[model samples]
Target: MSTAYVLVEQNNGQLDHVTAELITAARVLGEVTAVVVGEPGTGQGLAAELGALGASVVVAAESPSVTGRLVLPEVDALHILAAHNPGPIVLSANLGGNEIAGRLAARLASGVLCDVVGINADRTADQSIFGDTIQVSAAVGGASPIYTLRAGAVAGEPVAAAGTLQTLELPAATAKDVTVVSATPAERGDRPELPQAKVVIAGGRGVGSAENFKTVLEPLADVLGAAVGATRDAVDLGYYPGEYQIGQTGVTVSPDVYIGFGISGAIQHTSGMQTAKKVIVVNNDEDAPIFDIADLGVVGDLFDVAPALLEEINKRK
Candidate 1:
């Protein structure tokens, strides 16, 4: 039987949503072998969650020095886990997990695929292209296949399982000379963050002003159950939160539908959102760069148009 390794993410022992999805994705391939790498707080429920969802084994790396701050130390134990279980490794596509996935691929001399939405029973990825307009199933090449699963892209089904939980202590990680300091998470809006949004509505300089964004842009997003995003210009002008910017320097998103409200399409901005399945642009300038990639274009005053659009959406629902 093929064995799939699912890396469980923990934040002070709280299980991440991605963990459940990874377990669900593994079910399509074969039996799951879950692994957790970090400090042993009394509350890491990832292992039990994996077990409940049919993980055949759970390997935890507990070392005095192997803190969750770095990937090299975690990669060390991961190599050992893969050797014993020997199969594709799956992880979340978040910053920390993405880094580890890349590092592990380099160390193992393996093929790595990132931001996967789905998986097949034969251990292939259901990859997307052209802004999620196409779905293609692909397998990893090289010695071993490694994949990073994106959050909110996959749905999971739970299955009961009995599994072995092994705790392995490793050599203390060499503390990176980097100084430790207090960490504080950035404050985000109650509105869904862009990465986790199903539909994203973005604004640009075309929207007119920063004040207009809340009155016109935000209400529409709320109607559609969507998150708000912005082009680089919009972010710079304080029309949208910096975290809400989508581009090369910003987060990559693959939402079901992306509605560009008055955003003049910069190639950099399009590069980030081009992965969205359906793109709709609204700009008064008919020749705005955004229209070139837009599946639907509306040339009009957004102040007049957005209210009507929100009304239409609410009526449909």
Candidate 2:
């Protein structure tokens, strides 16, 4: 079987949930070779878990440059690996992953497929395009087609493998690379991360104000243990932080239940949450487009509906 390189996403020594999904997807193509690029000892720590997830080998490319510099180190590391054991390269389709895939593809002069949902036996990929309204099959012309898969595109199934560790020497950094000056971690609240959350409560411009997001939507979310999300308009209006924005340009979430308040159901926002199993929307506007896709649509003010929902849920608890 051909070797498929899967980039392992990690932060502060903890593996991201997407890494397992990448491994599972790569297994459909060939043997999985998980690649970890980070500070020294990062890969060593994650090898066992990667192996349990079906990675046949773990390539740990550790260096101080990885922590001090930006995306260039990753691009360099993957480029070097592709030079030797070239195959399908898989990565998450998030901001950093897309950038790395694009740069690496340019460096390797290979074709790249982004936002891919499935990999066929013939090596073609299935893509949801045009706000996910269209499904297309894509194939790369050259060897080692780089793919940036959407999160939740594949469910991970564990099939144990050797997970043999292989250390690679990263290429020396050049002047072209950007240098990091300082790093400050974002303050994380108790709520689960938006992308990984099983339940999501989102708001839009109809949410009225940031105060409303705090007092109204958040209370309901807290009761349901759902992650808080916002439309681009809400974020732009300063109702919520940009990181909480859910849209085509923002985070893509596939949750078991997605409840929206005051959203107009713009295609950009709907595309992000389209994979959700159940969608419940509340909007006073009777003709809101979001209602078109909602499993349960409530034509009522969110301020009234949200607090009532919160009270009922709390009463149940």
Candidate 3:
């Protein structure tokens, strides 16, 4: 049977949720083999969890010095391992994964199914694209086809599977030219990561000011245990961090529920968040474009509606 390699991601010894989702998708394709690129202390029981999720092979490279270094070794490993025991390759279609996918496809000289929402292999490789528009079936040339899966696009299910562990120890490659810099993780609440969050509460310019924005959206996210996002207008006006923006100029997310306040939906803006499973729009203008795609819409002044909504949510809590 063909083997599918799922590159595992761990932060502070805990597996990233995207890795779990990838393993779940791998079960639908073929035998799953997990690859972990970190020091021994990082994975905890993540590997075992992946095995329980149907991964039959687990590969580890425990290099302490190489732990956070952005090196080309990952792409190099893909070329080396797949050359001898060639099969399907799976990676999270996040920012980091896209970089590795590009390098691996170039080095391996193979076709890449990138930003693939879902993958199916019966007679051909069928993949769903971003922007909620296209689905394409693809073929590879001489090498095994590499694929990158979108976050939150598929449900994760893990089955019982005994895994064979392998460690391919390669000599450390040259460090990246970028200088070592002090790293500080941003302070956030217990909220879920933005892309992986099931619920997203967002703001826009209509919230009036930076202070007003927190009044409207943050409370809702807190109630829902959701991540906070902003429209390009809110981001440009400095009402929220640029990282919180969720339109064409911002991050693309497919959360279960998305709430947009005061944002006039431009196609560019919608292009990023249109994949959301449910959308709620609150704006003073009933004719606003954001309302066009909203499953639920409220045509009222945000200044009046937001406080009431916040109070109701607080009362419910």
Candidate 4:
């Protein structure tokens, strides 16, 4: 079987939620080789987990440079691997992943497919384009096809493999590379990360004010244990932080349940959450565009409905 290289994304020590999905996607192509670019021992640490997730081999490219600098170290590691054992490379379709994919493709002179939702046996991929209004199939004609898969696009299933460990030393950083002097981790609340959350509760301009987001939406989210999201407009209006924005210019989410409160259903926002397994929208405007795709729609004021829902859920709890 051909080898499929999956770039593993991890933080601190825990593997990112997308890593399993990437491994699952790689299985469709051939034997899975999971690549880890981090500090020493990172790959060894994840080998068993990777094997459990269907990665037959785990290539741990450990070096201080990986954490000390930006993007280049990962590119260097993948480039070196491809030089000897070239195959399809799969990465998460996030900001950093896309940049790495572009750089790696340029270095290898290969074609790349970004934001791919599905990969077929024939190697063609399904992509949602034009703000997700169009679904198109894309194929790359090259020795190596680098694909950046959208988060939550593929569900991960365990198919155990050997998970043999291989360590590679990354080249030393050069003057051309950017260096990280210091960093401060963002304070993420107790809620699960938005992309990986099974349930998400999003608010919009109709949420009224920042206080309402804290009072109305947050209480609902707490009851449901759902991640909180906001439309670009809500973010722009300072009702929520930009990092929590869900739309074309922001994060793409595919939760099992996506609940939007007071959103107008703009294409930009829907495109991000359209892949959600079940969509529920609460909008006073019955004709709101969001209702077009909602699995459940409630025509009511979010402030009123949200509190009642929260109270009822609290009762049930």
Runs in model 4 with CA error above 4 Å?
none
lDDT tens digits by residue: candidate 1, 165-239: 778666564555233455676775677768767899898887877788889999999888889888889889877
Q: Which ten residues in a row have the lowest lDDT in candidate 1?
A: 173-182
In model 2, residue pairs whose N, Cα or C atoms come closer than 3 Å (at least 3 residues apart or on different chains), thus clashing, are none
Question: Could you tell me the lDDT of residue 171 within candidate 2?
Answer: 80
TM-score, predicted candidate 2 vs. hidden true structure: 0.96
Ranking by lDDT: 4, 2, 1, 3
What residue pairs clash in candidate 4, if any at all? none
After superposition, candidate 3 runs with Cα above 4 Å error? 41-44, 122-130, 175-181
TM per candidate comes to: 0.74, 0.96, 0.88, 0.96
lDDT of 2 by residue, 1-317 (tens): 89899999999889888888888888988999999999889999999999999999999998877888888878887888888778889999988999999998888889999989887767899998898889999899667789998887787788999999999888878899888889998899999999889999999999999999999988888889999999999999999999998878788888999999999999989989988999999999999999899999999989899988988887898
Model 1 stretches astray by more than 4 angstroms: 42-44, 51-54, 63-68, 114-143, 150-164, 175-179, 219-225, 236-238, 247-258, 264-281, 286-297, 307-317
TM-score of 4: 0.96
Q: lDDT tens string, model 3, 131-241? A: 445668776654567888777666677787876677776456564523345678778668787778888888878887888777767777787788988888788889988
Model 2 worst lDDT run, 10 consecutive residues: 149-158
